[model samples]
Target: MKLLNVSAGKIQTVEIGGEKVRTAHVKMPRPEPWIITPDGAEGDERASHPDKLYAFARTGYGHWQAQLGVAPGEWNDGFFGENLTFDGLDETDIRVGDEFMLGEDVRLFVSGARTPCIKLAWRLNQPRDFLKTFAASRHTGVYLGVLDPGTVKPGDRLERVVHDPGMPSIADVCDYVAGVQAPVELMRRLLAFERLSPTLRILLGARLNAAEAAERAGRHHWTGWRDFRIGRIVEETPEIRSVSLSPLDEGPLCLPQPGQFVSVRMADPSGDMIQRVWSLSSYAAGMDSYRLSIRRQQGPGSNWIHRAQAGDTVQLKAPAGSFVLDPGSYHPVVLVAAGIGITPLMAMLEAHLARENAPAPVHLIYGARRPGDAAFLGELLALAAARDDFTLTQVYSQADAGDWPRSRITAGIVKESVRDTYIALDGRRIPVPWYESDIYLCGPGDFCDALRDELVELGGQPGHIFSERFEAAGMAPGEIEEAEVRFVRSGTAAHWSARSGETLLDLAERAGVAVSSDCRAGACLTCRTPVTGGKVTADLGDGSALLCIGRPATPIIELDC
Candidate 1:
């Protein structure tokens, strides 16, 4: 491998999304013989103290540019916050435990792949969708651990001193990090790699244990589809409505835990079936029906649901999601929501209140553009008034005249809410210490990310916070490249292009191909299928792609459909 460029920089403050954040080398320059250490380049800063030496690489930039139709010189070296840009090195060929001799004496060991964070998107001035795109691209560079810290410079020829044949490639490790389900043996092999970070090892071990437990439990996985009838429809707001559903067969409905979502399928104006997922907004231990509160958006699915009346029939699948309350924990809970995001959190709050024993105190901070846009406000207010364990803080971003304070939910507001000894709800001051609470965030992706970063800055444990997105956020239009998709099982092929603006599922359906799918948003993993050849970009990082949110990145994509 030939080192093309070496760069380093100290932490500097930059304004992003109207807030100042500390970032390193937004525009790093190639430096000659830069000092290298176990932590990182001498001047670089990262949260991980003495590990995760290298930040990023430029190996995949060429592929990204070709796929995205970006012009030359539109992006430069260090654009991805990477310290190293190399030539003639295949990123996929590098494996964990591979030792490289840098310059004459400096030795570096491959540790792991660089996990893309929100900051990288901010640095690139890309939209939020860029995060998923980068992960799907699988070119996120690699991290290195210094075995013999020394000076390394541009034009330094890198010689491989060692390679572990049993180890997985950085791409494989990245796939695992992106929520790909690995085989038990693969997990064990990764855990045994001595050069792997301790934190990563622990995570792999946990995943292995969980997979084993699930296998032993013999849990019956839900497949196929079921039918439901809308029992009631209530207008919650001018643009939002709550639909109550019941099984058509009069059988028992599947009980979903709080914060879980169910997939709903309906026909569009052209009679093409469209599938969308909505969170269960209310929870009753033995209820016979499920409630989904939906806000009308520009999409056809939401608009159709908004116009539907009671007694309308729809197809639905079982609830599937990992975003749920920790039943074993007794920690105080803080639920944060914006606009219609209050649905799932409401279910969680109700579940907590229904506990037989004394439950931990629950606080909710909800925001909306106006008082009229807030859904379930009356029910939430009544619940808070009736229970001492429940408290609510309402924030409106565009309220003209209101009794409540008008403010946007930000990191500052979250920190202030947590530090206060008592929470102010309406005119009542409820004594509650929220600093020690576990946080649950739901809303637009950008809003949730900002709140999460703030909470972490205020000493909140990253693991203690949970979040879910209402929809695939930041769907922006861009140039699309022409491609071909081949279905292995069906012995058929279809043409696709960026201008089609349709998911693989939609394309397949139009081409008379049958693929089982439920939630098309990449959350439920219902449309997951392996790509045997070529490349495809998706919203999620698993080895398989969600056809609902997947697009071709190469000239030809072969799917094991």
Candidate 2:
């Protein structure tokens, strides 16, 4: 593989069928190019280092789905870009954190794997696929964040360093003989891989360990102190229980930022462990233990919780989610939640309360069917009463005799409740934040969508709206496929064709087009393209593409951007 032109930012245009085609936005910004200066002279266009170059990932596909008007499962393919495309040797053996020599001296490493988002589905039209790919092997492939800074051109040969196919590679080899029923040779092929390299030996050892555990337990389970089992279960309402879990082991429960969730794996009727996730209703108050004010869910896990007695061990994982409490420094944060979504918010309020040492002023609104339906009613009310800086209000829809009025959360209700506090929702916003407050919105899909709309009209900023939704979080094989593809930026025209098992970056460089991308796993949008012609698909949620990563759904296309 040789060096070629390296371009960064949102793909301006995609060339298809010899005409200019518009590509959708991949909710990420473009990357800046490396400008090198010899000695102390002015920086030049060539690469600054012989070992590395900077680039961006195609985050477009994921961004597309966030477009409210788009339908689910619309975005088909995925996006990501790279400085060099690879070929000659099979690539299934690549592991993250491993490096390689490309096109002479350009050193590349597998920094991480690709993980896309739903924004793509809402944007270009594939929300479910976006999530699936994120958790599946399709999210595989190495993401070389950056190894060294250097200028690269076309016709460079890629040299492997510490070449090894990690578990992901062996996993693929075994897939051929899995549930579908395949030839015994497929098993032989996997075994053969075991002999090719010592790395393969370690890989097999790891797989066998996982497989054995799966066999004995009838499933794979991750054992960790992530599950938080808190205090005595007291029934405060018809459907809610206030139980608390503390940091039994150490490290502060990791005391994750507010709005994070932990996956709890439990046993089924047959005694097989199944997994489910729940958000922490309360944040780390003092690290003594965190609380989970849970409403009874319909699943077996929840049933276990409902039936469990004191001292029952509840397996848990630490907090995990990007919906963290914003620093609340850049802008005031506006938090919106409905029903059970209040769990994480309480943590945030507690955090502020601790900092201020006094009741910090915060605007809080909650909705429930009735006063009886409200869980943690006493706790929330107590917090409000004690903290003069905090204001708490409830809107109930069910017919009930209570101090609060019965009403659903309508735009008028939300507007009326907030006298002048900053707002936050779960995800990106539409109308833009009038107060420009960082908005964090969480809950079910409908709540997110509805609140997103209402908040926009209220001047919610797009960048300020940060949503955390739960759907598919892991990936399965065949869910996302890697393809041989190429992207060319020749003059103003870009060309592409079936790669026949080559990396997109290598092919583009060969064709004399340059791409500036990073984490070429289709998560970041550093290598997005502006489709001018031809048809392209993506799992990331963008309409156009990240030529550095995505494989062509159709065989041929032209670009003029």
TM-scores across all candidates?
0.53, 0.43
Error of 1 at 439 (Å): 0.8
* Model 1: lDDT of residue 510: 86
lDDT of 1 at 326: 54
For 1-561, candidate 2 gives per-residue lDDT tens digits of: 223233322334443222232333332222333222221111212111111222222233233344335454453222233332222223245443456665544566543333222232334344334444433433222334345545444445555576554324422433321222323343334435422322222223334433432243222223354444445778867776767664444344344566666656656669787566666666543355656666787767667777776666566754455566643232344566677777677676665555422111455677778777877778878988886556677878785324346666665555555535421221211221223345666556677778878766664545667765533321111222333233334653334444354344545656667776433334334566765544445423444666545545544544432
Candidate 2 Cα errors over 4 Å, as ranges: 1-231, 247-252, 328-331, 357-360, 400-405, 422-436, 470-561
lDDT of 2: 0.47
**Model 1, poorest ten-residue lDDT window?**
423-432
C-alpha RMSD of each candidate structure in angstroms: 14.9, 23.0
Best by TM-score: 1
